[model samples]
Target: MTESDHRAKLFGTDGIRGIANMEPMTVETCVRLGRSAAHVFKDGTHRHRILIGKDTRLSGYMLENALVAGICSMGVDVLLVGPLPTPGIAYVTRSLRADAGIVISASHNSYQDNGIKFFSRDGFKLGDDTEHEIEQLTFTGRIDDIRPTASEVGKATRIDDAGARYIEHVKRSFPNGMTLEGMKIVVDCAHGAAYKVGPWVFKELGAQTINIGVEPNGRNINVGVGSLHPEVAA
Candidate 1:
């Protein structure tokens, strides 16, 4: 049986997830996923792009580079927003008008786990049908023959301002005249995606924030801190 046949489903409700560096999350699978997604999102001769964002998982570095290699190999430019929230990636994807967005995260799961999710140009998570298409393409090898060379190959660019942009975007959601000047908030980032933004957003809005779980050593994410352990901040 093929990889797909052996595994009943490659993508769960939240995308492909597993122990980091293991079967589904392995670099080889990530490359295949990148190539398949690139093929599915291609839209004519116009240069296409995909935005990638991730949380503070050490495995993220390994997976991110693999995805970039695969996507770029298939001629899709990549916009990397290093270490941002999942939603921030979606917003940045639309903010930059990329063809699609990808998030490398496993939400509240422990650091040992990781996941991959996609978003459309509109900044919405991809639907089941589109995800299914990408999955099928990944295992079927139908996209292997379609490769771009020279200038046609895709390039990867880093979006240095992605965090600032997301900060501004989220700040807009608060009441126009509202400020957290008198509010004392305890912000526990769980050392995940929101580590930097969580405290900064509140502090900038004038809140006195007592921050815990802000120091992400990559492997410490969601370990005895963050949302999983609210008492840490409480």
Candidate 2:
């Protein structure tokens, strides 16, 4: 009924989510979200940067680009880590000291659905108050005149080593002096974000890994694979 009501409904438990190319998940909404998030996190003199990561959904590319455009318009740099896991985005966001982080994913949802969530520089999810501020900025026409021009405009960079970095971080969590040597394991990536780095982690740890659901065609994620279909790996 009012802008406040609309803002209240914009984000959910895990951020804005919907069917790809529809309603809140559409490019327009993503652009606004990008702009709003950028405005919220863009701090003083230092060049502000936002890290963005995504899953294997086909629409991820479209939404990712839209977010980049919106963030750049606010004169904030964007670091894109292609298709890393959600937590990986948070890790890399802190590793790179970004002002904020974003993840484009729908978790266990079908590939047709996608979501956007954010993180603070501390690699933690933004509090409800922070999310509310972003929503408020998105619906209001505020920050419309804060545009930077020429050299002040932001740019985007692809973090090619993001996946490798995440793998290293995960490996560190293993018990000290422990290795997967002499062990065999099955890994089903569900054709999702971990598709690339999932098996790699096991293999690097000296395990004989039988990998499935590693080949994602952007539409096959979670379709008869992943935890939903544990039998595939079993």
- Per-model TM-score, in order, reads 0.97, 0.97
Tell me the tens digit of each residue's lDDT in model 1 across 1-234. Answer: 367552457888888899999878999989999999999999987999999999999999999999999999999999999999988999999999999999999999998999999999999988988998898888886888998899999999998999999999999999989999999998888888898888989989999999888889989999998766877876
RMSD over all Cα atoms, model 1 = 1.2
lDDT of each: 0.91, 0.91
**Weakest 10 consecutive residues of candidate 2 by summed lDDT:** 1-10
Alpha-carbon deviation at 180 in model 2, angstroms? 0.8
Model 1 lDDT-worst window of ten: 1-10
lDDT of 2: 0.91
Which pairs of residues collide in candidate 1?
190-226
